[model samples]
Target: MTPAARLSAAIEILADLSARRRPAADALKDWGLSHRFAGSGDRAAIAGILYDTLRRRASAAHVMGSEEPRALVLGMLALMRGLSVDAIAALADGGRFAPAPLSEAERARLADSSLEGAAPFVRGDYPQWLHASLRHVFGDSVVEEGAALAARAPLDLRINTLKGEPEAVKAELSHLHPEPCRFSPLALRIKLDSEGKAPPVSAEPAFLRGEVEVQDEGSQLAAILARPVPGGQVLDLCAGAGGKTLEFAALMDNKGQIYAHDSDIRRLKPMHERLARAGVRNVQVRSPRGAEDVLHDLEGKMDLVLVDAPCTGTGTWRRNPDAKWRVRPGALAQRTAEQAKILEQAAHYVRPGGRLAYVTCSLLDEENGAQVRALLNKREDFSPVSPTENVLALGASGPALAEAALTSREGLLMSPRRTGTDGFFVSVMKRAG
Candidate 1:
């Protein structure tokens, strides 16, 4: 498909998403199924345009003076993709299967568009209602921080040390050209194309042979900071899909007992194959019989309990822009409630003097620092663990990493602006013996 046709496809998909309140991925897949003539490149291009529009939706609307799908696409092209006005006009020209040429009003607005004087939320490309929450979390740097979260993320893969070292995996997958991640020893990143697509690693020999798995660098850091000792008793209290569960396995060098449990069995269903693929033998999957019935035998016996709690996923906007728009205030309330329950429950399993690490892919304070504060307030036995110390204890360059990240009350919040990765918060609390 020509660039013009791809832009038209993106506008249509965005309209469909708005009308149905559907996810970007779902809309894109449906479009692909219906437009079978579109090749992989065409689909990729359309998806890139759509996600770019979503990522910069608010700012685009501000620039274009319109929030319609076409306006958003045009704004994205002009600003997000850095397309010149003439270039965008040629693509939006009234050619066959192309969107109508840019309207005079759109052209006028684009010609004079400026985000410098716009509202902070508009400049940040996030929803206006989230301004207060974002500011409360980021203080005066909210726009800078949110803009980074609005940008596209590179593809990151974690080498499965349970199977092989990073060098062996890097050598095995030389064709894809993976680079070592800046902050994680086990991570490799594949740079995204201009259209934000990475070389497909699913078919690579290393992945097929249990040497690597796709993971965000920030997530890799979170799992790394959990500080589970090798040969120690570890409970992955919310081990959905076992991404970090597998990481814990590698961290322990496959010598420790890692019990992976989740309240929802559906999420745990995929772990069996993934664990087997990563050659992680130390993990035992505990599928809950009820909402929170798993891990009965492990109470008061765990050396480390990892709670990768659920949240509104505001931190992952770079990857799931639609979610940031779709999320509601009520959803945040629901998540905080769930987090409180899970933290209290998971605390029971931490042995005396053992540590319970709380993790969330959320930048919201209510879901992160506030939750830790509540835990500390309720139970005087648990105290905040120094996130800087955790980073330092994990490696030789702990000071550098701690410097690169934000030190929260009891943890660290890693963001794309600071860490060149997705937003992740991790807090480790030690129990009194």
Candidate 2:
């Protein structure tokens, strides 16, 4: 398909997503199923256009003076893709299977528009309702942080040290030009093509050998900060698919017991296969039958309990741009409540003098600092631990990682602008002995 046709397809997908209030992936998949003639490359290009448009939706609308789907695509091309007026015009020319030509108003909107004068939220391309939440965490850095969050994210892989060294895995996957991440000693970053596709890591021998897993650099940091002690007890309280659960296994040298459990059993089902492939044996999958499951014996015995809690995922907007627009005001309340509940429930399992690490892939303070503060208020036995200790305890990656992340009162708030990672808030609190 021609690039013009791809843009048209993207516009159609965007319209459907907006009208039906569905996820971009669902809308894009439906488009693909019905339009079987579109090859993989065409579908990828269309999907890329859709996501890029969503990434800068508000800013692009402001630049085009309209919030219509086509206007967004045109503005995105001009502002983001570096396409000139004439270049976009040639594509939007009334050729067969091409988008309609830019209207006179669109041409003018694109002619001399600048985002500098737009509202801060509009300039940041995030939901206007989230301005206060973002400001609470980022303060003066909100716009800069939001812009960075709106940018595309590179693919990150965590080298499973239980299977092989990062050096060995890096050599095996060198064709993808993987580079060591600045913040994670075990992580490698891979840049995707313009169509926004990573190499089929799942099909690679290295992945099949359980050498590297697709995890974000920030997530790697979260797992690393947990610093689970070898021959100690650790519980991944919400280990969906066992990403961090697997990391904990390696971090503990597979000598300690790691229990992987989630509130939803369906999400935990896949961890068995993943754990098997990763050559992990020390981790146990707990399939709970009811609200009260098999974790009773673990109470007051666990050395560390990590809560990778449920969140609004504002931190991962770079990869899932549609999510930023879809997040509702009610979701903040719902997610915060859930996070608090999970943190409270998980805290009980932490032994005295042990750690309860709370983590979220969210930038909102309500789900992060506020929740931790509430917990600290309710549980006088627990006190927040400084992440500086974790940073200082690192062997070689300490200085680089220490410089990469920011120190937030909640814990370490790692943002794309500050840490060159996805948005993540990590707070480790200790239960008194």
Candidate 3:
């Protein structure tokens, strides 16, 4: 596909996103199905352009003085990707299957437009409503944090230490072995070149043998922050597909038990196969059975409860850029409320002196710091614990690194900027006796 054709595809997808309430991915998939002539390169290029435009839509609109897809594509090219107007015009010039030529007005607009005072647009491309919340969480470094959110992310894989160690997996895939991830012991960070394509890990022998799982370094770190102890009873509430549950079992050396429960039984069904493939034996998949089925016997008996609660997933905008465009304040508030309920329910399963870790892949404070604060405020029997200390105490890492990574207080909040991993908030709480 020509560059202009990619822009056209993005425009069509953006229209679908704006008209209906569908995700960009779904729309792009539908487009791909209808336009079967597009090859893999064409599909990827179009998808990349669409996502990049979504990531900076607000800012692009500000510069172009229009929110139309064509204007957005042009603005994004000029401002975000630094494509010159002449270059874009050349791409849109008389060519087969190319987009319509750039209008005279568009050329003038591109030349004269400046985004000097558009603080929200230039800083992070976020809506104005999010400024206060973002500032509340990031303080003075909100701009840098927003910039990170706008950028692309690399593919990260977590070595399934249950079947094989990281070193063994690396040795097996020696040719394709990625750089060691700084934030996660199990992660291998695969950096893509300017072409923006990650190598196919599924085709790798290590992946086929269940030696590694393609998970973000941030996600691997979030699971690690839970600090599962060997032979300790653990509960992964909201364990969708059991990706982290597999990690939990590995952490436990397949000893003791991990009760993996989710409201949706259909979601946990696939995990049975995944666990088998990974040689995970310690997990017992439990369907909610209308909340009481899994809740009755597990009350106040767990040593560790991991609440990988649902949220807006703002931290993952780099990978799922279209998500930023779909997020609304009301939806975020609803998610926050649900996260609180999940936390409260999961907290009930943690016995006195047991630990409960609340986690989310969101950059929002309401889902992270604020949720922990609310839980602490509402529950008399729960108190904040040091996450770094808990992990170190579990023998997760050496004392020197633990001391460097953790605060004098216990809660561990990892920013993508700080950790070079996913934006994750992990708050460890102790159920007071």
Candidate 4:
């Protein structure tokens, strides 16, 4: 397909997404199924255009003076891809299978449009409703932070020490030109292509042998901060898909007993295969059976309890830009309530003098520092570990990550702008002995 045809297809998908108010992946999938003649490259290109449009949706709309699908595609081509007005016009020249010719006004806007006087939300390419919450968190630099979140994310992989050494695995996957991440010693970063597509790392021999797992650097840091002891008792209370659960197993060198449980059993289905592939033998999956207290046997006996609570996923916008637009105030309220409840439940499993690590892929204070404070208010026996002590687990990388992190009274917050990572807040609390 010509670039113009791909742009037209992206516009069509965007219109469908806007009308249905659904996920971009679903919209893109339906488009592909219906247009089977389009080759893999065409589909990937269209999906890339669609995602880039979404990432800069607010700013693109403001620049083009219209929220129409075509306008967004044109504006994004100019703003994100650095296409000139003449360059964009050449693609939209009303040729067969191309977008209709650009109107005079579109030409003018594309030639002169700027975000100099645009609102903060427009400058940041985020929803206007989130401006206040983001402002509260980032203060004068919310626009910079949000713009960082709007950019494409690099693929991050954590080396599974249980199966392969980091240096050996890096050598095995050297074809991709992976680089070591700044913060996590076990992490390697793979840059997405110019079109914002990640390599199919799942097909690599190292990945197939469980030498690496696709995880965000921020997530790896969060797991490392948990500081699970080798041969210790640990519980991953909300171990969805067991990403961190697997990390914990490898960190302990398969010596500790790690119990992984989730409120929903369906989410645990993938972990069994993952654990097997990662050569993890220390984890025991506790599937919930009709609310019959799946984790009752281990309450108050854990040396470390990790609650990777659900949230609005504001920090993950670099990858899921559609979610930032779909998130609503009501959803935020629901997540905060759920986070508080989960934190309370997780605290019960932490043995006296043991630590509980609370983590969220959210930048909102309500889900982060506020939640930590609320937990402390309710549980007098639990006290927050200082940000200084939390970074100790990271060793040489600790001081740099500490300097990059935003320190709060209860925890540390990491964001794309500050830490070159997904938005994650982690607070470690110790239960009284």
- For TM-score, the strongest prediction is 4
Candidate with more favorable, higher TM-score: 3 or 4: 4
Model 1 segments more than 4 A misplaced:
none
- Candidate 3: residue 290 Cα off by (Å): 3.7
Model 2 lDDT at residue 8: 89
User: What shift in Å separates residue 12 of candidate 4 from its native position after superposition?
Assistant: 0.4
| Better candidate by lDDT, 2 or 4 | 4
On lDDT, the leading prediction is: 4
lDDT of each: 0.90, 0.88, 0.79, 0.94
The residue ranges of model 4 lying beyond 4 angstroms of the native Cα positions read none
Sort by TM-score, best first: what order?
4, 1, 2, 3
lDDT of 3 by residue, 1-433 (tens): 7777877777888888888977887899999999999998888888888888877787788888899888888888887678788988987885776778888888887886677777853657766777888888777888778877787788888888788877878887677758887746677888875646677788887787889888887677677777788999999998999888988888789999999988878888889888887999899888767636656788999999999888898888888887877789999989998998998899889988898988888877778877888888888888887654555642444343344332324366555666666677777888887
For model 2, how does the per-residue alpha-carbon lDDT over 1-433 read when each residue is reduced to its tens digit?
Answer: 9988998899899889879998999999999999999998898889889999999999998898778898888999987787888899999998988999888888887787688778889878899999998888778878988899888999999999889987878898989999888868788999988667777789999999899899998998898888799999999999988899998898888897998888899899889988988889899888788866689889999999999999999999999999999999998899888998898899899999999999999988888889999999999999988877666546677766666677755588888998889999889899999
Between candidates 3 and 4, name the one with more favorable lDDT.
Answer: 4
Model 3 stretches astray by more than 4 angstroms: 109-114, 391-410
> What is candidate 4's lDDT per residue for 329-369, written digit by digit as tens?
99999999999999999988888999999999999999999
Candidate 3 global TM-score:
0.92
Give the Cα RMSD of candidate 3. 2.5
The estimated TM-scores of all candidates read 0.98, 0.97, 0.92, 0.99
The CA lDDT at 226 in model 4 is 92
- Candidate 4, residue 386: lDDT: 91
**Candidate 4 TM-score, true structure as reference:** 0.99
